[model samples]
Target: MPPSLPFLLDRTDLHLAELHAARLDGDLVGVGDRFSPADIAGTVDLRGARELRALSLLPRLPVGLVVERRTAAWLHGAWAAPPGPLELCVRSDHRVRVVPDVAWSVRQAVLRPDELILVRGVLSTTPLRTALDLLRLPPDDRYDGRHRSAVITLLLMQTSGRERAAAALHRSPHLPHKQRALDRLAALSLR
Candidate 1:
């Protein structure tokens, strides 16, 4: 098994002695209040610790909101760039408001148990579902459905099998953007 990465914050010791110990051992460096790999100092650049930090904070987030869309893709390491803000999803029955730097999208239809997964110990949409959602996003400059087609296709192909991804889109007939996802999937499959 690979060695576990250092904790984003030392929870056990309130004073952060573990972080200090790591600093003494030359294993970690401090940047303001956060810590990063020792080689680079002055900033907390969490290149390898991103998943650990996200997973560590999962239990602390509000209930019923699973990470989704671009945030999920970034957590899955399928996206090249870091997401602008946290994207979370909740059922329409739940009244969640967008917070500063966090985007909360509500789903009219409830997500099935299988449609979500514990990725890196954090609840997030399954690979197939994430891809379909990406295809369903509005046509905006940042990630219009068309612009993300290639990334979504590759994400599905790598994280979930292409066959399974296609099947998921087929099964979700109620999705408002189901046809669009299907069309995108078809175009990608032909490549």
Candidate 2:
């Protein structure tokens, strides 16, 4: 049998009275879980953005939500900024309630089983998919050419270069955004 996953305590993990007592005593710091000091400072290298992203997300991500858009790119090494409000994708059937302070946004989409991957134990869009998603944004919504170029370079490196990116675009040619992805890829190649 596969080894069982380590228990990560969330609100539901504790009985109501215990949760309240832990919070009242300052033993539990965050809204989601009663995280110990060690869990707060994981083995992740403190200097890297990935570690920051993981730490910020591990406590806030809602059950069944998948990270996407610029957030996914940030997680995949395409951007250096700290993650802002959580951006997520969920199937049409899922219900997500508004979260205070966290400022989450969600997009409903038809997700193919293969479009998602895990990053630091969080489910996120693949690098290629994230690139494609970025390309689909209207010009004004997308980042500058220089940053986009960096994103393309990093994502391409993560996915073993151009072939896989090309294949992903080709596989979804019918998407209205395919040409946008092509344009972005072409622009990156010319740089």
Show how many residue pairs clash in every candidate, following the order shown.
0, 0
Specify the highest-lDDT model's number: 2
Largest TM-score belongs to which candidate?
Answer: 2
Estimate, for each residue in 38-96, the C-alpha lDDT of model 1 and write its tens digit.
65433434434445546544644566577777766665556644354556777555666
| CA deviation > 4 Å runs, candidate 2 | 1-52, 92-102
Residues 92-191, candidate 2: write the lDDT tens digits.
Answer: 5667664444567777866676778766677887766777777777777645764576457556555455567767778875776678777777667523
lDDT of 1 at 64: 56
- Clashing residue pairs in candidate 1 (N, C-alpha, C atoms within 3 angstroms): none
Off by over 4 Å in 1: 1-5, 9-50, 56-60, 92-109, 141-160, 189-191
Against the correct fold, how does model 1 do in TM-score?
0.61
lDDT of candidate 2 vs native? 0.63
